[model samples]
Structures are given as C-alpha cells and as structure tokens.
Target: MSADLLLSKLEGVRRTGPGRWVARCSAHPDKNPSLNVREVEDGRVLVKCFAECDVESILSAVGLGWDAIMPPRAIDHHVKRERRPFNAHDVLVALETELTIASLAMLDIGKGKMPSDAERERLLLASRRIRSAIELAVDND
Candidate 1:
C-alpha cells in the first residue's frame, strides 16, 4: 500500500501536539484513546496500545490485512494479522481531526480580535474557512 494512502486514512487519528495519535483499539473496549499509530522508517507503521495490548493484535484491530499492506514474503508471517476496516468510524475520526484544527484556528482568530464588531466578523470568517476545508474533504470523498 502507498504511504500516502495510509497517511490519508490516518488523518484524523493523528494528533497534532505532544501525543502523535488518538486511536481506538480493536483488541479492547476502547472508550477513550488507547492506541497510538505512527509512521516509522520505510513507511512501516508503529503501533502501541496504552492498555498493554500486543502489536499483532493491534494491527488486527485496525481492520487491515497484512497481505495487502505488507511485503509478499511477510504475507505468510502475518497471515493471521488483521485490522479494523476503514468504515464510518474511521471517517468520523478524520472529520473530528479536521474540526479540531479548525477550532484552533477559530480560537486564534478570536484571540486576535479586540473589543470591536470587526473582530467578531473576522472570527466568523475564519470559522467559515475551516468549515469550507471540511466540506471540500467530504465532497471529494
């Protein structure tokens, strides 16, 4: 699989600040963030579960099969490996990421404004910009 494709799929799950990701573990009842998926060397994915889950199990949880993503020689090795399918839940995650970024931008705009009507108008405009970015992503999909 292309790294770009995988990166796109991981858009929302990738956190922006200190922690690099926010993923729900498929191996456990993850009501909150329990997994961190990161891009390592040679486009390999590095995953760690906060709940003390194993790597293979975490791979299986994301709905990804090794054959399609791993090298041919490694296919048999990862035959039993699996990941959660990219579904509505994944989409929601991406959308949430986009929204979070947008929200930050909105906050920045708000902070920049003084005690004036123009500041409010600029904040609204900045928020619209964020909304537009999200709409574009959905439309393209």
Candidate 2:
C-alpha cells in the first residue's frame, strides 16, 4: 500500500537520489530500467515510464490502482457544507506584536541608534509579518 512497498515489488528498482528511483517497467519487456518513480514532499507518488507505457497499464502490471498515487480527498463531495464563522483574533494579535517591534525599532532610529544584528533581523521579520497580515485581510474581503 505504501510507496516503498509498491516499488519493491517491481524489478530492477535502484535509488537514483533522494526520493527518486529508477525501475524496470513491467508493462512491456525491458532490459534497462526505464520507469522513473519519485515520492514528492507532500507524500504523493509520481510514476513515469520513459518507454511510453500508459499509467493505467503500468499500475495494473504492478497490482495497483490509481488511488495508490493520488492524494486522498480532504472532504467528501457527498457531505453538505457547513458555514463556519470568520475569526480574526489571532491575526490581530500577531499584527499587534509585529507592530510593537517595528515601533520600537523606529524609536531607536529616531534616537540616532543603529539596530544590532538581532534587532535588524526582528525588524525584517516584523515587516514580513505585516505584509502577510495585509494579504490575509485582503483575501478575507
């Protein structure tokens, strides 16, 4: 059921690199490994047969269905949708914290003091957080 176990069932499977593998295609007679298998970061398996074998045929040869490589659906379409209330309390709190840091940095600048490396890093982070908050607010609208 797992990607590793499914790949092990194939012939001539070799590790090409991290999360990458070369294997012989079972759909047709082959001497060299022409199938490329990769496990993506999001836990989805990708299979490609350089010999031009179709996905359905390749999967059938190895006793697997399309579901083996497809990501599971988060929500069933058959279920009715529920309306959830929008909550911005956490976003507001984060914005407040970032603003406080930025204001402090501005005060230091007004006093003719250069920020230390750590303070500069904090200021950069606060700037990014403020931008993200603005984007989130726009998206909600």
Candidate 3:
C-alpha cells in the first residue's frame, strides 16, 4: 500500500521527515499525533502508535489488514548469483593440463609416428576435457 492512501485515512497527519509522517492514532482517542507512518524503500508501509497500540489494532481501526502492508515475498533486485561453478583460475589450470596432453600427442604425430594405445586414451581424455571446458565457459556467459 502507498503512504498517500494510508495518510488519507488518517487525521492530523504532519510530515516528520522524508518518507515519514505522524498522525493521530486511529485505534485510540488522541489529542496529539502519536501514530507513526512510513513508506520504506522496498515499497512496504510501516505503522506504529506511540501510545503503545499494537500494529494490528492500528491497522484494523484504519480498515487496513496485515496483507496490505506485508513485505514482498521475493525480491530479486540487484541479486547476483554465482553463474559459473569453476573460477577462471581453476578453469585455466584445467585447460592448460589438457593442452599439455594434446601437445605431447601432437609431437608424437609430428615425429612421423602415431600415438600408442595408451597415448590415444590420454588424447581422448584431453579432447573431452577441452570440449567440456568450452561448453561451461560459453553456457555460463
């Protein structure tokens, strides 16, 4: 609920500060403005009676309910989540290791001989790791 709507229902409302005001307590008879009303940055209305009146009682008197002034259930404003599971340093280290393996295999092939069975397995693992790193880097962005 907006502060203006709440203030309209109140009597003898006077500005106390930015986004804040004082009004006569609707729950009880008041000769002075004892009720405090405020609108916070998150768009929630706040009400308090200095005569020690409960919030529920003050809201009830003004035809307002708990639901009208409740805070938002979920606020996603400026929330930054961890988009990548692995940090850049870790990913770089992994890619470097895979590159070393691939380089060794390439060197063997450049020597006019194919990599042995075990070297072939290592090359396959390196290929898979490089492909996986590429996917993670692209998808997270």
Candidate 4:
C-alpha cells in the first residue's frame, strides 16, 4: 500500500524532513501531531504514536491493517537484527534503587550503627550493579 493512503487518512499531516512526517493520531484525542511516520528505502513504513498508543490501534483507527504499513515480502536472512537489552530509562531506574540502598546503609553507619551481614552484602551487590550499568552506558556511548 502507498504511504500516501495512510497520510490521506491522517488529520494535520505535515512533512518533517525527507521521508518523514508528523500527523495527529486518530487512535486517541490528540491535540497536536503526536504521530511520527517514516518511509525507509525498502518501502517499509514506520509509524509511532508518541501518546503511547500501540501501532496496531493507530493503524486500526485509520482503517488500515498491518499490510498497509508492512507489506509482506521475503525475509532477508543475512540482515542482522539489533537488540537493545537495556534501555537508558530502565538502567537509570535500577541505578536509583541501588543508590538508595547504599545511601540508607551509609546513614545507618553515620549513626554509629553497624550494618548487618545482609546489609553489607546488599551494598556489595549495589556496587556491582552500578559498575555493570556504567560499563553498559560507556560501551553504548
């Protein structure tokens, strides 16, 4: 299917840059153009709704099925699929929890109270997790 068909169904559609567009998502009551649409060289179209509406719902709202966006074709076995196992948001959330544990343990020590064996182990775990997160960020950066 043509991307023009999808854009025709969208309200407030406008070009952003080459092969990119912004439009109002019909799946939700969008006050602005919260939907992003991009056409790649492979003729595959990508659609994203910033309002967190699932792609399926957005497509359905426009009376388009998956075939409109993703035309079925032969799969390329040689292409490598990218995987981001740890996103920044999840990594930061984990780091925050670990830091909170260490902070509370430090406060206990400041009050002249010794942390138990479990607390010490948890502190060690926090340090390890922090180190791991740093490595992940650095390598990706």
Q: Could you estimate the TM-score for every candidate? A: 0.37, 0.51, 0.50, 0.51
- How would you encode candidate 4's per-residue C-alpha lDDT over 16-90 as one tens digit per residue? 999899999989999899999999877778899998999999989989987887656514323434445668788
lDDT for predicted candidate 3 compared with the true structure: 0.83
lDDT of each residue in 1-141, candidate 3, tens digit only: 468877888899999999999999999999999999998877788888888999898888989776666644413333544464669898889888989988888887999889999999988988898889888778887
Which pairs clash (backbone N, Cα, C closer than 3 Å) in model 1? 60-82, 60-83, 61-84, 62-83, 62-84, 63-83, 63-84, 63-85, 64-83
Residues 1-141 of candidate 1: C-alpha lDDT, one tens digit per residue: 333333344324656444245667667787776777665444355567799998666555565555324555454545544443436666577567656755766677689844346656655665676577566556556
Q: Where does candidate 3 stray beyond 4 Å?
A: 71-141
TM-score of 4: 0.51
Point out where model 1 deviates above 4 Å.
1-14, 17-19, 67-141
Give the range where candidate 3 is weakest over 10 consecutive residues by summed lDDT.
72-81
Candidate 1: global Cα-lDDT? 0.58
Order the numbered candidates by lDDT, best leading: 4, 3, 2, 1
Off by over 4 Å in 2: 74-141
Q: Which sequence of candidate numbers ranks them by TM-score, best first?
A: 2, 4, 3, 1
Better of 1 and 4 by TM-score: 4
Clashing pairs in 3: none
User: Top lDDT: which candidate number?
Assistant: 4
Per-model lDDT: 0.58, 0.81, 0.83, 0.86
Candidate 2 accuracy as TM-score? 0.51
Give the range where candidate 4 is weakest over 10 consecutive residues by summed lDDT: 74-83
